[model samples]
Target: MAKGKDVRVRVILECTSCVRNNVNKKSTGISRYITQKNRHNTSSRLELKKFCPYCHRHTIHREIKK
Candidate 1:
């Protein structure tokens, strides 16, 4: 028997606002989050609303390549 691929995979989510406007930012970094998702369940990219320290508020964080 062979091992199969994992259904749950780790993904990196980044702040959309930070990536869009990177120049002259209040913070020198972009907000990111690590989370696991089921590939079989949702094929599309993941989008989550998370708190961003730099943005100083909650923003829509979209999944990005690691």
Candidate 2:
């Protein structure tokens, strides 16, 4: 076993609803969360269920490119 170059990488999670509902004026400036993931243990993109202040509900937050 060995550690990869990107052992820990910074990632951003954005609200799925906010991105889809762009027409909504309130959806402006989508909510996002910053986090770090283990590249070796979990190389795949991470999707987390988090609360969105604008949406005011738990939404699927998917990892996005920096």
Candidate 3:
């Protein structure tokens, strides 16, 4: 068995308040909330929210690659 370097996991958080607010604002709405700066550093090992395929929802946890 061997470890793969190319494989990586990402966490994506979905805030309900933010999502609703953005939807209401229309033009300047989306940009006002979400930002590229919020994205997690791939190299960091911090727990975060990610889209889960099994649960069909976003989950907050640490991602591991086998």
Candidate 4:
């Protein structure tokens, strides 16, 4: 018989404004909100580099990687 406990998770949200220059603040805000909601099942944290077509810049976003 094997027994184990459930593992908790966490998520980190970042901005993706390093490409163009439109107005990704709203998008970033939304992303953060979403991440917050799913910050209870993340196994590993992975930083993702996303280039916003509207911002035309290289930004960062974190997520679970396992």
> lDDT tens digits, residues 32-58, model 2?
999999888888989999999988899
Q: Give the clash count for each candidate.
A: 0, 0, 1, 11
The residue-by-residue lDDT of candidate 1 on 1-66, one tens digit each, is 433588888999999988877875656789999999999998999999999988899999999987
Query: Against the unseen true structure, what C-alpha lDDT does each candidate score?
Result: 0.90, 0.88, 0.39, 0.43
Q: Candidate 4 lDDT (Cα, whole model)?
A: 0.43
Number of the top-ranking candidate, with lDDT as the measure: 1
Misplaced by over 4 Å in model 3 are 1-45, 63-66
- Looking at candidate 1, the ten consecutive residues that score lowest on lDDT are 19-28
- The TM-score values for the models, in the order shown, are 0.86, 0.84, 0.27, 0.30
TM-score of 4: 0.30
Question: How far is each candidate from the true structure, as Cα RMSD in Å?
Answer: 2.1, 3.4, 12.2, 8.3
| Segments of candidate 2 deviating more than 4 angstroms | 1-4
Position 54, candidate 2: lDDT:
82
> What digit string (tens of lDDT, one per residue) describes model 3 on residues 1-36?
444433443333343333455556632322111112
